[model samples]
Target: MEHPIPSRILVFGGTGYIGKYLVQASVSMAHPTLVYARPSSPLTPPANLKLRDRFRSIGVTIIEGTLEEHEKLVSTMKVVDVVISALPYPKVLDQLKIIDAIVVAGNIKRFVPSDFGCEEDRISALPPFEAVLEKKRKVRRAVEEAGIPFTYISGNCCGAYFVNLLLHPHEKSRDDVVVYGTGEAKAVFNHEEDVAQSTIRAAVDPRARNRLVVCRPLKNAISQLDLLSLWEKKTGRSFEKRFLPDEELVRLSNTLPDPENIPVSILHAIFVRGGTVGFELGKDDIEASEFYPDLKFATVDDILEVFLRPGAPEPYRGNFK
Candidate 1:
């Protein structure tokens, strides 16, 4: 049964990497979308200014504030039916404030936290990455304790983003790619747009409430070698593959500086350890593609074709650089 009124969505960190896509998806879904983002200043990047302009032009309500502002968060929570946090890794714990506000407001129907990467509860990653996951786990425990209607999204690897990192599609002169492990470990790589759209759909879904929804389409699953093969076929070029074994990834994860080590550790887990594909989803977990059959998600080939186009922009590097 379809509801007559659309859910009002308030997105925290909506101007960040995946957050922007979430905001776009929310608005595209005809939700009365509101974004709680940092106030813009002359110091803000031109690209970000352009994004803010685009948001305003499209009728998205932008509430400029910080997560620290308790009153503002509570008031905002009062207005929206769904609250989704796309706060990056560093700000994972800050959602506790959002939780506090939700409790005070007592009006939110659902809360989607910033667990958009791996299923933290499942895999055992390198120490650096495991530390990050621990922080997310803390948020999960808090949300469950608060009894907030929530959906934990395990989006796996973002398609174009990881593809750009692995293939260097923007660098025409580059002729080699790094393959983690033997390049035999398969992982899911869902397009960011699909993840965003499915997230929005799941945020309001009755079945998705209080469950973990994984964005793992069978067609999107492929090994590093398979991905390379597809890219080589698309560009009509064969590049040399340099294999980075598990020991080297372990060394980098251990030796690299604080946050610099974090990405390497994550790469170790996903590429070398097969962290994304190691476990089967529990019975309560929802595989997004199967749950929403009508939503057509892009495959790895489709993403490669997008890169082959002239003047295609480089995917957002995020912290993977």
Candidate 2:
């Protein structure tokens, strides 16, 4: 008997927060990974430069080009079986270029767009957050219209990112935590690595093709108050709970400008409106845990434990600014 060769993967925005994990997961699973990133110059941030060097050392082929380069995107897409885009929210519409290139290449087995967040199609959020979801929905429509084989990932809340923001584990001197709404709305918080691993698995999975792969493990589903209590137990410290009601969240969402209101609106959606856990998985949907039983994913408790460590570094906040 012979083993099947791993699919070749091309990752856009491969040096980003979640993108790095996707690239790593692809390489770990023995996929010949390639990264299409902006060409680095002296103006490039040192951290980004180091990430590129690290990827090079790990044998990831780096293709230097922007999304505007249609010829380059087409040529690059021609060589890979899968294209995973981890571009941030601001660049959501930019995926249209990738879609055009995929159509021209006509060989990609799967095209996973940058949707490692909530199930946009199902949830009704505040205007700011809804705008973001609308952009993602637009991309989804484009992909479907182009007849591209694809997978849409709704990985829910990134665990470390949210835990750090909500709990402020790094701020040891801080004595209080913000409890959104009544702190009882259940939401899914998945580790970034787990999100990436499951995404990589689904990119090659026939069952996941053209399906919405949701990363909602049972253990990871907990309320804001539950997360607060867990962190309290882990640190053996009781912090003051500052409750921010839904009305105030909405007010802030309306008052705050641009990106600032974006995160606040998201908080209202997930914590107050129960955006993540609100919907039922339809016939087109598949829960990641059940879909990939063999893949072990870290829970909220596991993520909290990391933050409890003395020198645990903070997770990248990305666009949650």
**How large is the C-alpha RMSD of every model relative to the true structure?**
1.6, 1.7
Per-residue CA lDDT of model 1 for 215-265, tens digit only, reads 999898899999999888888999999999999999998899898999888
Tens-digit lDDT track for model 2 on 10-112? Answer: 9998999889999999998889999999999999899998999999999999999999999999999989999999999899999999999999999999999
Candidate 1 residue pairs in backbone clash: none
Local error of candidate 2 at residue 284 (angstroms): 3.0
Per-candidate TM-scores read 0.97, 0.97
Error of 2 at 317 (Å): 3.2
- State the TM-score for model 2: 0.97
Regions of model 2 farther than 4 Å from truth: 1-4
Question: Residue 203 in candidate 2 has what lDDT?
Answer: 93
